[model samples]
Target: MKTRIVRVLVTDDHPIVLDGVTLALQNTPWLQVAGYARSGREAITAVERLKPDVVLLDLRLPDMLGPEVVQALRAQDSAVKIILFTAYPDHAALDAALAAGAHGAVVKDTERDDLVDAIRRVMAGERVLCINAAGSSGAALSRKLREHGLTRREYDILRRVAMGETNPEIAVALGLTRNTVKTYLQRTLEKLGARNRVEALSRASQLGIL
Candidate 1:
C-alpha cells in the first residue's frame, strides 16, 4: 500500500510568498497543501481544523512572532511538527524557533530541494537546521557555550546527546569510555544548571549553542 501523504498548513504574511510556496509543493506526491494562513490567529485556527502533519510557518506573521505561533501550536498539540520559513536567516531567529519547538528552519531563499528535504527530515523525526542560515555567526552560540560553562569536550558530547545518542554510542563516537561520557554529561548538566539532558539541550538551543 502507498504511504499517506503528509498534510501541510502554510502561513505567511505575504501573498506572493505563500503563492510561491504553494506552487513549489504542488507537484510533490508525498505532500498535500491542506491550508494557508496570513496571520498567526488564522494559522492557529487552520492548524486546529486541518490537523496537518506539518506546518510551514513564516517567522514574521503579521499578527504575532513566529516563536509565539510555534508555542501556541505546541500548547494545542505537541505532535504537530513545525518548519520555520524565514527570509531573515539570522541566528537569533533560528534559535528562537528551535527553542519554541520548531522541528526545522528553512530560509526563504533555500533551494526547492532543500526545503523539501527539511520537511521530509522533520517528518522522519530528525531536527533539521539550515546550516547556511544557522552557521553565519558562532558568536551567539559561543556565548551560550560560555554561559553554560561547557568545556570543548562537553560541548561535543552535548551535541551528540541532542542528536539522541546513547552514552555508549557517544563514547564510541568520541573514542572515550562510556563512564567517561556519563561523567562529561553530569558535569555539563551541573554547569548549565540543568535537571536533565532534555533541559540542557533546550537551554543550549535557546542560547543558540545547539
Candidate 2:
C-alpha cells in the first residue's frame, strides 16, 4: 500500500530554519513541504491559497504570536491541522498556543524523525506535544480550562482584562457588542467566584489560568 502524503505549510521568520525544515520534510516519504511563509499574515495567506493539510507554525512570528496565529487559522479552516514548531524557551507560551487550537507542538531542536512522528501522530487524530524536556504536561492548560468550565472566549476576555483592557475596548478588539462583552465578563466573574474584575483576575492568576 502507498503511504498517504500530508502536505504541510511551514511558517517561520528565519530563512535558514525554513530551508532546513523544508529539506527535512523533503526526505520524508509521507510528508510534502507544500509551501513556506515568513510571518503570521503570510502563513494565513499561504494556508488560504495552498489549503495544505497541515501547518507547521512558528511560535513567534513578526505580525502575531503563535496563539493568535493558531486562533486565526482555526477560525478560517477548522479542518486544517496545525502543529506549533518553536524554539521559544517559555512553557507558558506553548501552553497558551496549544489552548488556542493547535493539534500538537514540536521543539525546534527535535530530530527529523521525531518531527515526522509528531506530524504523523497529529494526522492520525492524536494530539502530539513534544517541547523542551523541562516543560510540563502538554494538556495542563487545557485541563485547567475544562475543569474551570471556562470557554475559550471567556479565557480570551480574561486575558484582555489581565492586560488592563476594559469591556468597551475588548468589545472593539473582539468585534463584540458592549453588552455582550459585559455579559461574558459577568459570567467569567461568576465562574471565578469574584465580585469584580480585579478579584477575578487575581483568582485566575493564582490558579495559573492567566
Candidate 3:
C-alpha cells in the first residue's frame, strides 16, 4: 500500500523559520512542501495560485493578522484547511483563530513529530487545538472576553475598524446602518480602554481579543 501525500503550503516571514520548517517536513514521507510564502498577502495569493491541500501559517504576518487571513480565505469560499503555526501561543488568539475557521493550530516550537501528527490529524477530519505548554485554554479566552465586556457585535465592528473600514463601508459590509456601526465601535473602544481606532486595534491584539 502507498502512503497518502498531503500537499502543504508553509508561510512564515522569517527565512530561518521557512528553511527550518521545510527541512522538518522533508523528513515526513507523506507530506509534500508545495509552496512557501513570506507575507500574509503572499500566503493568500499562494493559496489561490498553488491550491495546496493544507496551509501551515504563522499567526503573526507582516501584512495581516492570522485570524484575519483565515477569515479572508474562507470568504473566498475555499475549503482548504489552515493550521496556525504561531509562537505567540496566546489562548485568546487561538480562540479567535478557531472562530475564524482554522482547522488546527500548533505553537512554533512544536516538536517535528508533533507537528507532523497535528497535520495528519487535521487531514483526517478532526479539529486540532494543540497549544503551547504555557498557553491558555478556550475557557480562559472566553472569560477574558467576558471580563472586557465586549459583545459579539462590538467585536465584529472592531475588526472592520481595524482593517481601516469607514463607518458607511462597515455598515454596508455588515448589513447594518452607519449609526449602528459607529455606536458599536464607540462602545468597543470604551470597553477596550482605547481612545481611537488604531489604539483599539493595538489593545485588542495585545489582549488577544481579535
Best by TM-score: 3
- Model 2 spans with C-alpha error above 4 angstroms: 89-91, 134-210
Q: Relative to the unseen true structure, what is the C-alpha lDDT of residue 79 in candidate 3, on a scale of 0 to 100? A: 79
Candidate 2: tens digits of C-alpha lDDT, residues 1-210 = 887889999999999999999888998888999999999889888989999999999877766656668888998789999998878534345667777789998889999999999999999999987877435644565677788988878988887775556889999999999999999999999999999987887787667575
Q: What is the lDDT of residue 16 in candidate 3?
A: 91
Model 2: lDDT equals: 0.83
Question: How high is the CA lDDT of each candidate model?
Answer: 0.80, 0.83, 0.81
State TM-scores per candidate. Answer: 0.65, 0.68, 0.79
lDDT of 1 by residue, 99-158 (tens): 668998888888878888899999999998775647653455556567667777887787
Query: TM-score of the candidate numbered 3?
Result: 0.79
Q: List the pairs of residues colliding in candidate 3.
A: none
Which of the two, 2 or 3, has more TM-score? Answer: 3
In model 3, the worst 10-residue window by lDDT is 132-141
- On lDDT, the leading prediction is 2
In Å, residue 188's CA in model 3 sits off its true spot by 2.1
- Over 1-210, each residue of candidate 3 has an lDDT whose tens digit, in order, gives 999789899999999998989998999999999999988788888888888889998887777776788887766546788999988676566666676789988888888999999999999999987776434655666676788998767877776665556999989988998888888888888888889887898888878776
